[model samples]
Target: MSFKYRFAYYLVGFVLGSFFVAAVLTGKDTRCNYFPNARVLNDLRNKPFEYSKEASTVLAENWIDTTDIKNTLTYGDVDFDKSNIKFENGKIYIVEGKTVKNQAIELKVINYTSKAVLKEIKKK
Candidate 1:
Protein backbone atom coordinates (compact mmCIF):
# COMPACT_ATOMS: atom_id res chain seq x y z
CA MET A 1 0.00 0.00 0.00
CA SER A 2 1.18 3.55 -0.72
CA PHE A 3 1.94 6.05 2.11
CA LYS A 4 -1.21 8.15 1.36
CA TYR A 5 -3.48 5.09 1.38
CA ARG A 6 -2.08 3.89 4.73
CA PHE A 7 -2.65 7.33 6.30
CA ALA A 8 -6.23 7.39 5.07
CA TYR A 9 -6.87 3.94 6.50
CA TYR A 10 -5.46 5.02 9.89
CA LEU A 11 -7.62 8.17 9.93
CA VAL A 12 -10.76 6.20 9.13
CA GLY A 13 -9.96 3.66 11.87
CA PHE A 14 -9.52 6.47 14.41
CA VAL A 15 -12.82 8.08 13.47
CA LEU A 16 -14.68 4.74 13.70
CA GLY A 17 -13.16 4.02 17.12
CA SER A 18 -14.24 7.37 18.48
CA PHE A 19 -17.77 6.90 17.14
CA PHE A 20 -18.06 3.46 18.73
CA VAL A 21 -16.88 4.72 22.10
CA ALA A 22 -19.34 7.58 22.05
CA ALA A 23 -22.18 5.23 21.18
CA VAL A 24 -21.30 2.90 24.06
CA LEU A 25 -21.12 5.71 26.57
CA THR A 26 -24.42 7.27 25.50
CA GLY A 27 -26.23 3.91 25.29
CA LYS A 28 -25.47 2.86 28.84
CA ASP A 29 -27.94 3.80 31.60
CA THR A 30 -25.43 5.80 33.61
CA ARG A 31 -28.25 7.43 35.62
CA CYS A 32 -27.98 6.25 39.21
CA ASN A 33 -29.95 6.84 42.41
CA TYR A 34 -27.95 10.00 42.94
CA PHE A 35 -29.76 11.59 40.00
CA PRO A 36 -32.13 14.41 40.96
CA ASN A 37 -35.20 12.72 39.51
CA ALA A 38 -34.45 9.50 41.37
CA ARG A 39 -35.12 11.02 44.79
CA VAL A 40 -38.32 10.13 46.62
CA LEU A 41 -41.05 12.78 46.90
CA ASN A 42 -39.15 14.76 44.34
CA ASP A 43 -42.23 16.54 43.13
CA LEU A 44 -43.23 17.67 46.59
CA ARG A 45 -39.66 18.43 47.66
CA ASN A 46 -38.01 21.77 47.08
CA LYS A 47 -35.56 21.72 44.16
CA PRO A 48 -34.07 24.00 41.57
CA PHE A 49 -36.65 25.18 39.07
CA GLU A 50 -34.96 25.74 35.75
CA TYR A 51 -36.99 27.73 33.26
CA SER A 52 -36.17 29.40 29.98
CA LYS A 53 -35.98 33.16 29.81
CA GLU A 54 -39.26 33.45 27.98
CA ALA A 55 -40.99 31.00 30.30
CA SER A 56 -39.71 32.82 33.34
CA THR A 57 -41.00 36.13 32.06
CA VAL A 58 -44.39 34.66 31.37
CA LEU A 59 -44.52 33.02 34.77
CA ALA A 60 -43.62 36.26 36.49
CA GLU A 61 -46.17 38.29 34.58
CA ASN A 62 -49.12 35.97 34.88
CA TRP A 63 -48.43 34.10 38.09
CA ILE A 64 -47.27 36.92 40.29
CA ASP A 65 -50.06 37.38 42.79
CA THR A 66 -49.45 39.10 46.15
CA THR A 67 -46.37 37.79 47.97
CA ASP A 68 -47.39 34.15 47.74
CA ILE A 69 -48.33 32.96 44.26
CA LYS A 70 -49.89 29.51 43.99
CA ASN A 71 -49.68 27.44 40.80
CA THR A 72 -46.66 29.35 39.66
CA LEU A 73 -44.94 26.11 38.78
CA THR A 74 -46.23 22.73 37.79
CA TYR A 75 -44.47 19.41 38.36
CA GLY A 76 -45.19 17.82 35.04
CA ASP A 77 -44.83 14.02 34.67
CA VAL A 78 -44.25 13.79 38.44
CA ASP A 79 -46.76 11.80 40.50
CA PHE A 80 -47.00 14.32 43.36
CA ASP A 81 -49.84 16.83 43.55
CA LYS A 82 -49.34 20.00 41.51
CA SER A 83 -51.23 22.38 43.79
CA ASN A 84 -48.47 22.25 46.39
CA ILE A 85 -45.82 24.04 44.25
CA LYS A 86 -44.44 27.55 44.43
CA PHE A 87 -41.61 29.07 42.38
CA GLU A 88 -39.31 31.85 43.48
CA ASN A 89 -35.99 32.85 41.95
CA GLY A 90 -34.51 29.56 40.71
CA LYS A 91 -35.81 27.46 43.59
CA ILE A 92 -39.10 25.59 43.99
CA TYR A 93 -41.03 25.60 47.23
CA ILE A 94 -43.53 22.97 48.31
CA VAL A 95 -46.00 22.67 51.15
CA GLU A 96 -47.55 19.56 52.61
CA GLY A 97 -51.08 19.73 53.83
CA LYS A 98 -51.78 18.47 57.33
CA THR A 99 -55.20 19.52 58.59
CA VAL A 100 -57.74 22.20 57.76
CA LYS A 101 -56.18 24.93 59.86
CA ASN A 102 -52.53 23.75 59.80
CA GLN A 103 -52.38 22.72 56.15
CA ALA A 104 -49.80 25.11 54.74
CA ILE A 105 -46.42 23.81 55.95
CA GLU A 106 -43.57 25.29 53.93
CA LEU A 107 -40.73 23.20 52.49
CA LYS A 108 -37.82 25.36 51.52
CA VAL A 109 -34.53 24.23 50.03
CA ILE A 110 -31.67 24.14 52.55
CA ASN A 111 -28.93 24.97 50.06
CA TYR A 112 -27.47 24.00 46.72
CA THR A 113 -25.10 21.43 48.19
CA SER A 114 -27.54 19.64 50.50
CA LYS A 115 -31.05 18.28 50.00
CA ALA A 116 -32.12 19.07 53.53
CA VAL A 117 -34.86 21.33 54.81
CA LEU A 118 -33.69 24.83 55.60
CA LYS A 119 -36.82 26.12 57.30
CA GLU A 120 -40.41 25.10 57.94
CA ILE A 121 -43.22 27.65 58.30
CA LYS A 122 -46.69 26.94 59.48
CA LYS A 123 -49.61 28.98 58.22
CA LYS A 124 -51.01 31.29 60.90
Candidate 2:
Protein backbone atom coordinates (compact mmCIF):
# COMPACT_ATOMS: atom_id res chain seq x y z
CA MET A 1 0.00 0.00 0.00
CA SER A 2 1.40 3.40 -0.95
CA PHE A 3 1.70 6.22 1.64
CA LYS A 4 -0.88 8.32 -0.21
CA TYR A 5 -3.43 5.49 -0.30
CA ARG A 6 -3.03 4.75 3.42
CA PHE A 7 -3.38 8.46 4.27
CA ALA A 8 -6.54 8.75 2.25
CA TYR A 9 -8.07 5.74 3.97
CA TYR A 10 -7.21 7.13 7.39
CA LEU A 11 -8.72 10.49 6.57
CA VAL A 12 -11.92 8.93 5.34
CA GLY A 13 -12.26 6.83 8.47
CA PHE A 14 -11.62 9.81 10.73
CA VAL A 15 -14.22 11.95 9.03
CA LEU A 16 -16.83 9.21 9.12
CA GLY A 17 -16.18 8.53 12.79
CA SER A 18 -16.52 12.18 13.67
CA PHE A 19 -19.74 12.51 11.73
CA PHE A 20 -21.20 9.45 13.46
CA VAL A 21 -20.26 10.81 16.88
CA ALA A 22 -21.82 14.17 16.18
CA ALA A 23 -25.01 12.69 14.87
CA VAL A 24 -25.33 10.43 17.91
CA LEU A 25 -24.65 13.26 20.31
CA THR A 26 -26.99 15.76 18.70
CA GLY A 27 -30.03 16.58 20.81
CA LYS A 28 -28.46 14.72 23.73
CA ASP A 29 -27.04 16.26 26.86
CA THR A 30 -23.55 15.02 26.25
CA ARG A 31 -21.29 16.68 28.77
CA CYS A 32 -17.69 15.98 29.56
CA ASN A 33 -17.16 16.96 33.20
CA TYR A 34 -14.08 14.83 33.82
CA PHE A 35 -12.04 17.42 35.69
CA PRO A 36 -12.60 18.17 39.36
CA ASN A 37 -13.70 21.75 38.80
CA ALA A 38 -16.27 20.86 36.17
CA ARG A 39 -17.52 17.91 38.23
CA VAL A 40 -18.06 20.03 41.31
CA LEU A 41 -19.71 22.84 39.40
CA ASN A 42 -22.11 20.52 37.60
CA ASP A 43 -23.05 18.78 40.86
CA LEU A 44 -23.79 22.07 42.57
CA ARG A 45 -25.73 23.39 39.61
CA ASN A 46 -28.01 20.37 39.50
CA LYS A 47 -28.92 20.31 43.18
CA PRO A 48 -31.23 22.62 45.08
CA PHE A 49 -29.56 25.71 46.51
CA GLU A 50 -29.96 27.45 49.84
CA TYR A 51 -28.39 30.65 51.06
CA SER A 52 -27.22 31.52 54.54
CA LYS A 53 -28.41 34.67 56.23
CA GLU A 54 -25.24 36.55 55.57
CA ALA A 55 -25.10 35.35 52.01
CA SER A 56 -28.67 36.37 51.43
CA THR A 57 -28.06 39.76 52.93
CA VAL A 58 -25.01 40.27 50.80
CA LEU A 59 -26.88 39.27 47.67
CA ALA A 60 -29.70 41.63 48.45
CA GLU A 61 -27.38 44.50 49.22
CA ASN A 62 -25.33 43.95 46.11
CA TRP A 63 -28.41 43.53 43.92
CA ILE A 64 -27.45 40.00 43.07
CA ASP A 65 -29.89 37.18 42.74
CA THR A 66 -30.13 33.46 42.14
CA THR A 67 -29.69 34.04 38.43
CA ASP A 68 -26.37 35.70 39.11
CA ILE A 69 -25.35 32.87 41.36
CA LYS A 70 -26.33 30.36 38.72
CA ASN A 71 -24.34 32.24 36.12
CA THR A 72 -21.34 32.24 38.42
CA LEU A 73 -21.57 28.53 38.97
CA THR A 74 -21.78 27.98 35.25
CA TYR A 75 -18.67 29.99 34.38
CA GLY A 76 -16.68 30.23 37.62
CA ASP A 77 -13.28 28.82 38.43
CA VAL A 78 -12.89 26.75 41.54
CA ASP A 79 -10.09 27.71 43.90
CA PHE A 80 -9.05 24.24 44.96
CA ASP A 81 -6.37 25.57 47.29
CA LYS A 82 -9.03 27.37 49.31
CA SER A 83 -11.62 24.59 49.07
CA ASN A 84 -12.07 21.74 51.55
CA ILE A 85 -13.24 18.73 49.59
CA LYS A 86 -13.06 16.21 52.42
CA PHE A 87 -15.35 17.74 54.98
CA GLU A 88 -17.51 15.43 57.08
CA ASN A 89 -20.90 16.70 56.10
CA GLY A 90 -20.19 18.04 52.64
CA LYS A 91 -17.36 19.40 50.57
CA ILE A 92 -16.68 23.13 50.54
CA TYR A 93 -15.97 24.72 47.18
CA ILE A 94 -14.85 28.28 46.56
CA VAL A 95 -16.10 29.55 43.23
CA GLU A 96 -14.91 32.86 41.82
CA GLY A 97 -16.39 34.58 38.79
CA LYS A 98 -18.22 37.65 37.55
CA THR A 99 -21.89 38.43 37.97
CA VAL A 100 -24.36 39.28 35.22
CA LYS A 101 -23.38 42.91 35.59
CA ASN A 102 -19.69 42.01 35.30
CA GLN A 103 -19.06 42.45 39.03
CA ALA A 104 -16.39 40.13 40.34
CA ILE A 105 -17.50 37.96 43.24
CA GLU A 106 -16.59 34.89 45.18
CA LEU A 107 -18.91 32.27 46.53
CA LYS A 108 -18.47 29.84 49.39
CA VAL A 109 -20.58 26.79 48.75
CA ILE A 110 -21.08 23.60 50.72
CA ASN A 111 -22.00 20.68 48.49
CA TYR A 112 -24.28 18.28 50.26
CA THR A 113 -26.04 15.29 48.77
CA SER A 114 -29.47 16.89 48.88
CA LYS A 115 -28.60 20.52 48.30
CA ALA A 116 -25.90 23.16 47.94
CA VAL A 117 -25.66 25.82 50.63
CA LEU A 118 -24.26 29.21 49.83
CA LYS A 119 -22.34 30.16 52.91
CA GLU A 120 -20.96 33.50 51.81
CA ILE A 121 -20.85 35.92 48.90
CA LYS A 122 -18.15 38.54 48.67
CA LYS A 123 -17.62 41.20 46.04
CA LYS A 124 -14.11 41.51 44.75
Candidate 3:
Protein backbone atom coordinates (compact mmCIF):
# COMPACT_ATOMS: atom_id res chain seq x y z
CA MET A 1 0.00 0.00 0.00
CA SER A 2 1.43 3.42 1.00
CA PHE A 3 5.19 3.67 1.76
CA LYS A 4 4.55 4.64 5.43
CA TYR A 5 2.08 1.82 5.96
CA ARG A 6 4.46 -0.69 4.34
CA PHE A 7 7.28 0.45 6.60
CA ALA A 8 5.16 0.06 9.75
CA TYR A 9 4.00 -3.40 8.71
CA TYR A 10 7.59 -4.51 8.05
CA LEU A 11 8.70 -3.23 11.43
CA VAL A 12 5.94 -5.10 13.22
CA GLY A 13 6.73 -8.28 11.30
CA PHE A 14 10.39 -8.01 12.19
CA VAL A 15 9.63 -7.52 15.89
CA LEU A 16 7.24 -10.49 15.92
CA GLY A 17 9.73 -12.70 14.11
CA SER A 18 12.45 -11.81 16.57
CA PHE A 19 10.22 -12.62 19.51
CA PHE A 20 9.28 -15.99 17.99
CA VAL A 21 12.89 -16.86 17.41
CA ALA A 22 13.89 -15.86 20.91
CA ALA A 23 11.12 -17.89 22.46
CA VAL A 24 12.10 -20.98 20.52
CA LEU A 25 15.75 -20.63 21.40
CA THR A 26 15.26 -19.80 25.07
CA GLY A 27 12.55 -22.34 25.90
CA LYS A 28 13.66 -24.90 28.45
CA ASP A 29 13.57 -28.62 27.70
CA THR A 30 15.46 -31.72 28.64
CA ARG A 31 19.10 -30.87 28.17
CA CYS A 32 21.66 -33.52 27.36
CA ASN A 33 23.36 -34.63 30.57
CA TYR A 34 26.67 -34.48 28.79
CA PHE A 35 26.68 -30.71 28.73
CA PRO A 36 29.70 -28.45 28.23
CA ASN A 37 31.51 -31.53 26.93
CA ALA A 38 30.42 -35.01 25.79
CA ARG A 39 33.59 -36.49 27.20
CA VAL A 40 32.16 -36.32 30.73
CA LEU A 41 29.51 -38.82 29.71
CA ASN A 42 32.14 -41.16 28.31
CA ASP A 43 34.18 -40.82 31.46
CA LEU A 44 31.20 -41.43 33.67
CA ARG A 45 30.04 -44.42 31.66
CA ASN A 46 33.49 -45.95 31.80
CA LYS A 47 33.59 -45.87 35.58
CA PRO A 48 30.17 -45.24 37.01
CA PHE A 49 30.99 -46.67 40.40
CA GLU A 50 33.79 -44.43 41.54
CA TYR A 51 33.78 -43.85 45.28
CA SER A 52 33.20 -40.59 47.13
CA LYS A 53 33.21 -39.91 50.85
CA GLU A 54 29.44 -39.73 51.03
CA ALA A 55 29.16 -42.86 48.92
CA SER A 56 31.45 -44.68 51.29
CA THR A 57 29.37 -43.68 54.26
CA VAL A 58 26.17 -44.83 52.65
CA LEU A 59 27.64 -48.14 51.61
CA ALA A 60 29.08 -48.78 55.01
CA GLU A 61 25.84 -47.98 56.77
CA ASN A 62 23.62 -49.97 54.38
CA TRP A 63 25.26 -53.38 54.63
CA ILE A 64 25.48 -53.97 50.86
CA ASP A 65 27.88 -56.77 50.05
CA THR A 66 30.82 -56.09 47.72
CA THR A 67 29.63 -58.69 45.23
CA ASP A 68 26.15 -57.19 45.22
CA ILE A 69 27.61 -53.78 44.64
CA LYS A 70 29.56 -55.04 41.64
CA ASN A 71 26.45 -56.72 40.37
CA THR A 72 24.67 -53.37 40.41
CA LEU A 73 27.13 -51.97 37.89
CA THR A 74 26.08 -54.50 35.23
CA TYR A 75 22.77 -55.76 36.49
CA GLY A 76 19.72 -53.54 36.29
CA ASP A 77 18.03 -54.72 39.49
CA VAL A 78 20.35 -55.28 42.43
CA ASP A 79 18.54 -54.79 45.70
CA PHE A 80 19.65 -51.53 47.28
CA ASP A 81 19.85 -50.96 50.97
CA LYS A 82 17.65 -47.88 50.93
CA SER A 83 18.82 -46.78 54.34
CA ASN A 84 22.30 -46.16 52.99
CA ILE A 85 21.24 -44.28 49.85
CA LYS A 86 21.41 -40.55 49.48
CA PHE A 87 20.92 -38.15 46.58
CA GLU A 88 22.52 -34.88 45.75
CA ASN A 89 22.91 -32.76 42.63
CA GLY A 90 21.23 -35.29 40.37
CA LYS A 91 23.53 -38.13 41.37
CA ILE A 92 22.64 -41.26 43.31
CA TYR A 93 24.97 -42.66 45.94
CA ILE A 94 24.59 -46.32 46.82
CA VAL A 95 26.59 -48.02 49.59
CA GLU A 96 27.09 -51.74 49.37
CA GLY A 97 28.83 -54.00 51.88
CA LYS A 98 28.36 -57.26 53.68
CA THR A 99 27.64 -55.61 57.01
CA VAL A 100 27.79 -52.25 58.71
CA LYS A 101 31.14 -53.22 60.24
CA ASN A 102 32.77 -54.00 56.86
CA GLN A 103 34.21 -51.80 54.13
CA ALA A 104 31.49 -50.62 51.77
CA ILE A 105 31.91 -50.01 48.09
CA GLU A 106 30.51 -46.77 46.77
CA LEU A 107 28.47 -46.86 43.60
CA LYS A 108 28.02 -43.53 41.94
CA VAL A 109 25.53 -42.95 39.18
CA ILE A 110 26.62 -40.19 36.88
CA ASN A 111 24.23 -37.91 35.03
CA TYR A 112 21.33 -39.17 37.03
CA THR A 113 18.53 -36.62 36.71
CA SER A 114 15.90 -38.29 38.83
CA LYS A 115 16.27 -39.17 42.50
CA ALA A 116 14.36 -42.42 42.27
CA VAL A 117 16.33 -45.55 41.55
CA LEU A 118 15.29 -47.51 38.50
CA LYS A 119 14.23 -51.09 39.05
CA GLU A 120 17.18 -53.44 39.20
CA ILE A 121 17.37 -56.07 36.46
CA LYS A 122 18.73 -59.55 37.08
CA LYS A 123 22.24 -60.20 35.84
CA LYS A 124 22.34 -62.39 32.77
Q: Cα-based RMSD of the predictions, in order?
A: 14.6, 3.1, 13.5
Model 3, runs deviating above 4 Å: 1-45, 77-108, 111-124
What do the candidate models score in CA lDDT, each in turn? 0.40, 0.90, 0.44
Order by lDDT, highest first: 2, 3, 1
Report residue 38 deviation for candidate 1 (angstroms): 17
Q: Return whichever of 2 and 3 wins on TM-score.
A: 2
* Candidate 2: tens digits of C-alpha lDDT, residues 1-124: 9999999999999999999999999969989999988998999999998899989788777468788898999989999999967666898999999878898999999988899999999889
lDDT for 117 in candidate 3 is 35
Each prediction's TM-score versus the true structure: 0.27, 0.75, 0.27
Cα shift from native, residue 66, model 3 (Å): 2.7
What tens digits encode model 1's per-residue C-alpha lDDT throughout 1-124? Answer: 9999999999999999999999998989563446443353443334543334443453355323212322212221222453224434223434433322323333333223334333332332
TM-score of predicted structure 2:
0.75
How well does candidate 2 score on lDDT at residue 109?
A: 96
**Model 2 poorest 10 in a row by lDDT:** 56-65
**Clashes per model (N, Cα, C within 3 A):** 0, 0, 8
lDDT of 3: 0.44
Highest-TM-score candidate: 2
